[model samples]
Target: MSTVHIKPVPVTPAEVIAVARESARVAIDPEAREAMARSRAFIDDIEREGRPVYGVSTGFGALANTFVAPERRAELQHALIRSHAAGVGDPMPKEVVRAMMLLRLRSLALGRSGVRPEVADALAALLNADVTPWVPRHGSLGASGDLAPLAHCAMVLLGEGWVLADDGSRSEAAPVLDAAGLSPITLSSKEGLALINGTDGMLGMLLLAVADLRHLLVMADVCAALSNEAMLGSDRPFQPELHEIRPQPGQALSAANIHLMLQDSEVMDSHRNDLAHAVQDAYSMRCAPQVAGAARDVLAYAETTAARELLSVVDNPVVLADGRVESTGNFHGAPLGYAADFLAIAAADVGSISERRVDRLLDVTRNRGLPAFLSPDPGVNSGLMIAQYTAAGVVAENRRLAAPASVDSVPTSGMQEDHVSMGWAAGCKLRTVLDNLGTLLAVELLSSVQGLQLRQPLIPSPAARAAIAAVAPIAGKPGPDQFLAPVIEQVRHLVQGPALRAEIEAAVGPLR
Candidate 1:
């Protein structure tokens, strides 16, 4: 993987995804190092003058009014990190941890966190070495900038916490650093506060969610097209002129994609002039573009918010270019919280509609001439009966997870940090919703491909054919059901992976 050079400018979502999911190495730009050094001087001046700054010379949160003696200030920094590292739950995924590390490094490199150049360099070194700290899944209220989760990451910088090896076993940070030819750094003044005081954890997850949702949204369109063909639904609703009149960008894009995918389809062409077909199909078939397109628009809105946040310096007591160390509320995670929650709601609806399409494809009466559950021997073999149940189960779970986490906040730090954002919780739930959405789409693909196979003499469009061919090995022809769970999982992998998209795009050009 190529190195993702960190500069003072905002980092892109792609860079975050590359570093997080692809294990890309990171390096600090020279200009960013210079900026960090310049900012460090301001903190040093405040320290020398004995001025009482929020995190520089005084305590934090509820203890902000407390003063620390000069001699014990270093101990105060260490104590802050140790006490705040109170996260509890299963360890976060390695990708999330890595993304958090990269995002923190980006914030530091922006030269606003009042840390020494070496502090930023240490974070970059950790990323380059692929040494991820073991951050917990819980303990962040999303206000005060993901305190506990970031504190766990900061502990690794001090060589005081646990780090995960390549194989995922944990070891002491000191030994890991030693093996990696790195040493722990002593914290001075605001360095510890700077390290842990940011919304990096929530932002990292949001960016990752954005990247994944982008792909899944396109796949949503693809699956809708496949399901439409399988159920012999009309393509008239997806006409360019029909969507052009509405002019919702996402809706137009979705309509265009479905319209193009159904071009030259024998199944669709077979019924193009049939007078007996229903004047309008069910909402799941006729309004796929509206539902999936609205989800696309929501994802775009989240992306816009994420882009603005990528340029943000989300820390308390940020150092200013005018030589003042000021305390600010930039660390509040409300924006990220709202974005994650909104995306979750949209994703859940998309999954819900996809499951509806799966049901339509499985029903004997509704699936036109297809078998019940698409089984060759309907009663003897339970073709995909349980698969619809699985999709329905996941859709219900997605709906439950879609309840906005941002609206529920609990005060902490003795009410000093009240009205927390809970953005991290929102991001966590969005991840699950997206994962479930992928599974729901996979189930639809499984049933739709079987439906299309049963429509044998009348071929699906080239793009649908390409999609069916891609999953044919794993999801074989419409026959007696074999072990179904493994096949659904394998198809889910294909849905989430790039190969299926590549094949479809190859046949019908790119989807929105």
Candidate 2:
């Protein structure tokens, strides 16, 4: 239960992952209070002086032309929250909600959002209390922030929405606030706008996707190595000297990892000097690093995008240090949208390549001397034949999901938001891509493990053996496949889980 302290600066994507996955407690830096106080004072001054600031003394979006009275400003803020909390779907996973809240707190703490310091503190308190607001999965267009999704979060702070308890039950925010020894503060001028107008939801999901892809990519290399050995594919292409000339960091790293995984193998030694050996392995086996490495490079770009976003203040009409409120397009989710779409493409390509390797292992002509579908009885037992079909289906879905969501836009709010990012949609789709990648790799793990077993006594490298051990508990040893669906699911679980990567890294000296 370590605390992640939030200062008036950008947090790293790694920190976001820690909060999302580890449930890390959050603390606001004391210095940020000054900025928060100044923003509040600025908002108060402008409101008292009858200044026509958007979302403060004026209506939102298409109604920005209309002026709001001082007496109704509070009610205006209340109504804005009520109207914008329009998300409709299953509640977002708790981790995503917590990450969104943490990011919003950091943004407000920057003193750029013109919100009270309590708004930031209350956010941290809710996260620390583990009372995650039930944010819906849809309704955001990724313009004017993640509006609909974030507004659901804002609703809880006003005690007008639902809170998901730590135990997974949904309860009214009012009682949840009471049980947490807290009370919801009434919204101040522009506070509702401040809460909902950010890219936290999409950005948080992007950060999580980045972390997941990193692990899955490394695990992908392990799959390639196992496939290479099982298919008796040569490792010469993975030699350091071959990749060194090109100097692509991710490519070189993947090559080096595969080389390590294929080392010290009796299977390789058996065919090392054979004169009749195939001149080259299939592209799926030989060009694994190239395909997987290309994906890795794209992930590097996505990381850069996530890093830039994690520390941004994505609100409309951000209040500056000189106490001036200026409207800006910072709330547009275009940058995050592009990043998310790119990651989806990369995930699909990598998963598609791994699926190819699985097919190679199941094909008698390509699998060297292994039985068809790695089945002991061939036609008598279906073995992992359908598993390849499952992987193919997932890969196809990923391909469809890879179409960039950022490029599509529809007008909303009386055409005030004419070009929406659809970044939220991109995030949602990338999550599905990542998940399919895991299942796709699990199919490879299942088939490749069987291939390694069928190779008999020609032990794979220590790295491959360690990886096998990590996955064997769930993937199990070769036998008449019992309920292949559950086995694939379990293997998919282990692929997404830490066990396989941990053991392989422990043996192969980290798959970086």
Candidate 3:
């Protein structure tokens, strides 16, 4: 297995994916271990001196007014994690739970959480051994961290929760921990609180969403190129100089991508001097770069936020270099919540444009004279008529899902957390929107590929031709509409990932 050394540095989405998927193992940095020792010593001092440290001597939440004696401190932490593991609904996906665990480990390894180095080691061991905790999907308020979900994750470290084995067997966490050659760790002072406090869950989902949408946005640009070429739309709008006037980096990049991918096309050159050709294409055909590019700009902001969060130690009563521990409100998830919601809005709009392009490609009135629906038998066969309906349905759902979850909040923790980020909710909705967008892009790509094929003896650009060829096995050439549901599903699976992108890039170099 590839081993990832865990330190107090910011991590990349790729690293998170590698460890979360178990393609990589984790190791503790020696310096981090030493730092944890020192932080733990500071906590020890507070306890020995009998000062009512927040999580150490005092009870939690509004119950902070209550104090516990030294003898019951260990029980206090166990009770804390057990009580907080109160989430409901189906379990989160294994990868999301794994990513949360890995991120929480990164935060604790910073040595500011006052956790014993052994706690970090146990978490690393659990991840490396592929013992995934079955974290519940709901109940996080996103204010005092992702308390419910993270608590479920933290429970597996203490051998009190359910574990899903790599072989798909489910068992009690204690036996699974033993099988992995690990034992439950007793929580030290402040350890339980640290384990659950952070914006890591929402941040982890946001990080994954950013990585995914980056690829999908590129795919959207490629699909847009195909749609424009099929519509015989002018490429003059994609002129580099024209984009330079506006100077949006994302817009410029998208225009450059279309400019390069559609270069040297026989079909495009054929209509260059045809005065009969329409002066300009519809906005969906002409304004693709602006729409897709603006989404790219939003993604850039999300990436910046994710990078800063990766390096941050987000917890209350964080340990300082001078050996002081002070409670702070760094656990608020507003930054991640806003980023997730914004990306959802962008993804939904991208899907909206792609859906419109699908409609234009299938309509006889708007399709610029391809066979109606590109059907070989025309009126006799229904062709891809219903496919547009499916795309429209998904796009409409995405529009609804795009409504910002961050703007809504509900009181919890006895009104102590009256305002919440709802970032977890936002992250969940964004994932659904992104998945729907991929399906919508797949439909657009299948429709465009058919339109290009029907244009036939009229050759397209080398990149467009190669994409048609690459997807032929899945989308096939237009004929009497044959069982389109399976074909659409096959095409959706291919376009949802890097295969078609690989073919396009091979002919046109890097798209970015």
lDDT of 3 by residue, 1-512 (tens): 48777876666778898876655888989987888888899998999899987888888888877999899888998899999999987777777877888899888878888989999988898887888887777988788989999998889989898886555445789988898898899997788998999988998898888988999999999899999898888899999999999999999999999888778888788789999899988999889999999999999999999998898889887989787888888898999999999999999999999999999998889888887877878888978899999999999999999999999999886877788899999998998999899899989988898998888798899889888887788767888778878887787777777788888888889988
TM-score of predicted model 3? 0.97
Better of 1 and 3 by lDDT: 1
Better model by TM-score: candidate 1 vs candidate 3: 1
Q: Which stretches of candidate 1 lie over 4 Å from their true place?
A: 166-168
- In angstroms, give how far residue 291 of model 1 lies from its true place: 0.5
lDDT of 1 by residue, 453-494 (tens): 889888789988998898899978988779998999999999
Clashing pairs in 3: none
Evaluation by lDDT, superior candidate among 1 and 2: 1
Q: Give the TM-score of candidate 1.
A: 0.99
The lDDT, on a scale of 0 to 1, for candidate 1 is 0.90
**Candidate closest to the true structure, highest lDDT:** 1
Q: Give the C-alpha miss distance for residue 70 in model 1, angstroms.
A: 1.0
Give all candidates' CA lDDT scores: 0.90, 0.88, 0.87
Give the winner by TM-score.
1
- Check candidate 1 and list the clashing pairs: none
Give TM per candidate: 0.99, 0.97, 0.97
